[model samples]
Target: MVIMTATEPATAGTAQTETGTEIETASDAGTAPGPGPGTGSAPGAPAGPVRPVEALLLVDLQSAFVAGGEAVPDAARVLDRSRALLARARAAGALVVHLQNDGAPGTVDEPHTPGWRLHLPVAPGPRETVVRKTGDDGFDGTPLGALLTDAGVEALTLCGVLSEMCVSATARTALARDFRVVLPHDAHATYDVPAAPGIGESVPAALASRAAEWALGDDVEIVARAAEVTFTAARPGCGTGSRAGSRTER
Candidate 1:
């Protein structure tokens, strides 16, 4: 796994860190119970008929990765955005899947290590799915793929720590599997690491954002922020329409 640090100054036209600030604080913005199966809406609008998305995949939002001391830089800044996405997803009735990186034994992220658990403030809901994996790619050797297929998901909205590592890998895997991927760049973060092990090199945020943009290709859509990503009521032929139901986790 290659750890790259980002040092580009926040610039105009780039994904802004506060894209979802308004939605995050609006008290009226609660999870809306989606329309039940067989009930469809007009096409192309917010109320348009949407494929039943059974899950919201969150990558490596663990304590070891987000809290101070072991946290990713700007991790705190992104929590509200992450939480806002989670809330909207739940309202639209998508399953919340939390992915945790399990390092090799004796490492910082090993099972039972402080770093292995998810960060505080955002807890998993009762029906949420939590999957643990020993590799950077959450789907590698894990049941994530099967669970998603089983739930009949047609798309995936991914967010979490380390924009260049697990998030990138998981997005690639999802695309290869033919699943529509939605990635909001501002909802993710990464740490600065010396590019040559000992030598300093900053992984430009533009590069990270561009990599995410490229990953989607003609199939994926990159939204500027999580709030811009629409979540609608599930309709029939789309499988189960329950909000906050089962979804694939990464």
Candidate 2:
């Protein structure tokens, strides 16, 4: 057997110690310091570059979930924020995707029903895409993943209705599929679910949002306000970053 000894390649910043041992010099110390206390990514969020993707996923923002309709609590506010986000994304030429929930015949959100349509506040443009799904996860039985994949989307910003249900489900599934997820705290909403027998009472709208934010943990990046959101294309080494807004700790 030929035993070949390998020597470490010397770097310009390295030096030989007094004992003749190779050592890293002060100039070779390339450590990037971690964020100090109170100066880092949002609570529970992992730190990274956080480059926004071209894709903006507005999940379950159906007409039925708005005010004067089926009513997702505080839908008006959610709509307002979502509308602003849509405008910003559109102006930036970001690809908009609306997720619609389909229900059985004669029920809300049935095919062709008004309830099944995307809300006007954040309606998709003629060129924007709409994906319909029967399950809470938008990718379930739908071409959502294919659409995103074909479009070369790696990171996604999420905002829409039913924070704890459809939005949460889709976000989790997106993350599972290796897509970076971003959550603007002001851009999503949910309803208060009433308590059921043997089940805990439904949390209030505000609480539900907080819970979903916390449940999403460090995987979903939370921005303080929707206005702070930027729909820039994903840059290399981007995922999460130092948050400029408060994180939902629930």
Candidate 3:
């Protein structure tokens, strides 16, 4: 990940998945760095030409996970930061894609159910739209990859719920696709893991989120705040930076 400042050094540790499976990996729990000079614009500032056109990918920001009484710890903060990013991305004419998860029948986020609805209102247009997925990875069986490619999106900022699940899975694929992925430290969250027999005590949501981000390796750009991320309009027909059919990690 691109450290915005010298003060913010990256850190890594072990973490567990939602299924109680443990994975020893790198973690980035520290405050993320901001964009380097000329790489991003301040809120309401014109997008800089030097930065490649970028996109904003909101993964599973559904009401089931981010709203009401069942929300994750610090859900309010995640929502607020995500909302701020959406507003700024819209103002800058950046490509915004909201990945909505369609939970199975009887599940909290069942299709067309209240909990399945998106927490934030979507402004559907050529630049902004929603993609529904049935899995943790947004691009697994969705048109997300095509959409990004058609728009010539090279870099993207990812935010949303279940830091170790949908959010982390999607980010991993985005990185493999060679997208310059930027994950704002405060814009994503997950539920506190329940204590397992002999595994360990209950893990805090904050720490799980950190472990998830850290597992993405060092290809992603971890920013301190959502406001620190900037966007540029997608350059249609310009082609994407994706390494098609290649699974090599950067």
RMSD of each: 13.8, 21.1, 11.3
lDDT of 3: 0.72
Give the Cα lDDT of each candidate.
Answer: 0.57, 0.63, 0.72
RMSD score of candidate 3 (Å):
11.3
lDDT of 3 at 217: 69
Residue-wise lDDT of candidate 2 within 1-250, one digit each (tens)?
Answer: 0011111220122222113333221111101112223343333343433455667887777666774657787788888888887777787777677776776899876755667666643333433556667778887767676666665566678898888889899998877777777776777888887888898976678777767766765556666556656685433333222221222331
Candidate number that wins on lDDT, 1 or 2: 2
Better of 1 and 2 by TM-score: 2
Off by over 4 Å in 2: 1-50, 121-127, 197-202, 233-250
Sort order, lDDT high to low = 3, 2, 1
Report the number of the highest-lDDT candidate. 3
Candidate 2, residue 21: how far the Cα is off, in Å: 76
Per-model tally of clashing residue pairs: 8, 1, 2
Instruction: State which candidate has the highest TM-score.
Output: 3
Per-prediction TM-score to the true structure, in the order listed? 0.66, 0.70, 0.79
User: Candidate 3, residues 138-204: lDDT per residue as tens digits?
Assistant: 8887778888888878778888989999999999998787777878888999999999998989998
Worst 10 residues of 3 by lDDT: 6-15
